[model samples]
Target: MSAVVDMPGAAHLVLADGVVHLDPEPAVLEAMLEGWALQQRTRFLNWESTIRPRIALVRRLTRFTNEYPWQWDPAEVEAFFDHLRTRRPGRPLAVSTARNYQNDLRLFFDYITDTRYGWPSMCNERFGRAPVQLLHEWNTITHTSEYEGAAERRPLAYDEVQTLFDAADGRVGEIRARRRKGSLAALRDAIVLKTVYAFGLRRQEACGLDLCDLRRNPRVADYGRFGAIFVRYGKASKGGPPKRRSVLTVPEMDWIVGVLDQYVSEVRPAFMPGKHPAFWITERRDRMSLRRLNEAFETARQAADLPPELDLHSLRHSYVTHLIEFGYPEKFVQDQVGHAYASTTAIYSHVSDEYRNRLLRRSLQARHGDLWGQET
Candidate 1:
């Protein structure tokens, strides 16, 4: 009779106490135990609370088990996977989401097989299943296998920006001087919107900035104004050698410093949750969280009569596009945006004419009158 065993240092199923124990190496056992522990810890945590947290944990588990070989009965695994596919609930799961779940399962059981327990060895050999092939079929059905396109999009046009700026300015002015103070909150809101749009900061990055991050300086220098800011890696990133604070350019520095001063001196001090590491605040004096910042952007978007779909991250996309339009190299833009791959940076290379026109002109110049009189 086969039974699962959890011995002092090793854990696996056995046919008897010592019926030829297989995969007895300590390193393998430890690795297997580690994978199990990860699963246990992940399961203990409440995954139902948030989808992001659940996805993150699932990814972590996937990474942990990716090294092991598939050990489960392939047919059993395939059946379970099919169940996951057919399981209906609220919203339909995206193809990407299903693939992610499959990846996690592959890692988990593969590690168990890599442990080389006799039962796993037997199970791996006996299981003849095509889960991976089925996953490919699912992908084909969902059309997710098509090349995921790049996201580099054009920024709002100059006219649009001007319109938004003028509208915000009027609102802020009214809020600042009004006797009834009906729209007095507009002053702080306008400052927030301008700083975000002008600087092209990530919503969280903008929300995360502290007063100390801004180096306020009155001096103007040759390389544009002399103020500076340190762009800290956001919470979404796992802190490591890759993550660090980067220096902002002059214009970005200026926007941040101006907002910092306004928030600190005029707006922040009056609010209860003002002037903390967070720069923006709500009318209730609460430090502006990213969620609040999103809401604020929506409110400002409506007030400015801008497109309803626009969000704060659009500011970052706009920033990258502006740089590209101004003829900055892909590498330079990538560095500014903290992207490691040029392909990732190229997402911002959408059909915005700023840089495209320059390249097109160069191409035309190279031809130089060759086709001037060609028949149509």
Candidate 2:
């Protein structure tokens, strides 16, 4: 047994046999690791999304090196990553994924080594060595580019988007023709896919919507009660609750008004949802889960014979691209998607070549009109 002696800035260890063990056992270090995680939470990082993954990465590093934080070195970091790369020879880790692992390790070490956190001093008093940063600029990946996502994750072309929607609608038709029991569910899935694309919502945001989130826009009275969606569960920044935004139903996507109106007035009530607030309900009268949302997108994508690489998030990308093509301002699109930076919205936009050519033609025509003092 050992006893911990708490001091002003450090903790000293005293063993049962009166011999001081400078380095504490790995099990004893769990408390300190947990404290570090808690400190991150206090700084406004989401517990489940940010802090948990950070702690998990640290634990992974520990397991790979069989060493505690104080004992770790840059060489161990390198070796651990090397092991990861070689472990799956056929499918080595992507550069972006590897970069994330390095960045997480860097942040964890930075926290532990900072004197303000008390971890370095505590480790020094107990182990005679303090935690050192194991990740450095020379060894770690540099974020030189704005986009690091997979090349395959891209916006759907206009035809591809139409095909996906048709497939979703076709599913409902197929079910109805057979008099299947799940036709209502199939139609619900179809509308969900369209809504995600129409509003450029993240999967979680879409799944987290409540019936009341839909509201009537005074200016767009013709759209009825489906004029806008108040997204209360927009993706949050580190340590913040979910962000909120109001996505107004634009004219180009007004077709969703009818679909949503029908769902709310007719289809949703059949689920026997008396008090459930979710806009999308299951047969069990529960809110749709993010997994279910993804499954719906997958079903539609496969039915349309689209690329396997395109996932539900691609719908958001398509929304951004199409909005840009429709001549909306960048800042408006940024706000619509709840992007903190316009650069993030740009990452999602993959405008079509035809749109670019159209823009070029418009510019040329305007120039010729000015030069000739007449219509070009």
TM-score of 2: 0.88
Model 2 clash pairs?
A: 22-126, 22-127, 44-239, 45-239
> Which lDDT value does model 2 have at 265?
86
Give lDDT for model 1: 0.54
Give the number of the best model, judged by lDDT.
2
Q: Taking the tens digit of each residue's C-alpha lDDT, what string does model 1 give over 1-376? A: 3343443222343222434445533334344454454444544433333334544543453344442233224454455555556778744445566655766554444435333333354434334421122233433234434334222224566566667667766767666576556353566666777677655667666776765666433454432321555667442332122244454554433545655466667776666663456556666655677776776667666777987556666666676777777666777777777666787666654546656777777788678755743576
Q: How displaced is residue 316 in candidate 1, in Å?
A: 0.9
lDDT values of the candidates?
0.54, 0.84
Per-residue C-alpha lDDT of model 2 across residues 110-149, encoded as one tens digit per residue: 7666666567666777678888987888998888888877
Worst 10 residues of 1 by lDDT: 129-138
Considering summed lDDT, which 10 consecutive residues are worst modelled in model 2?
A: 7-16
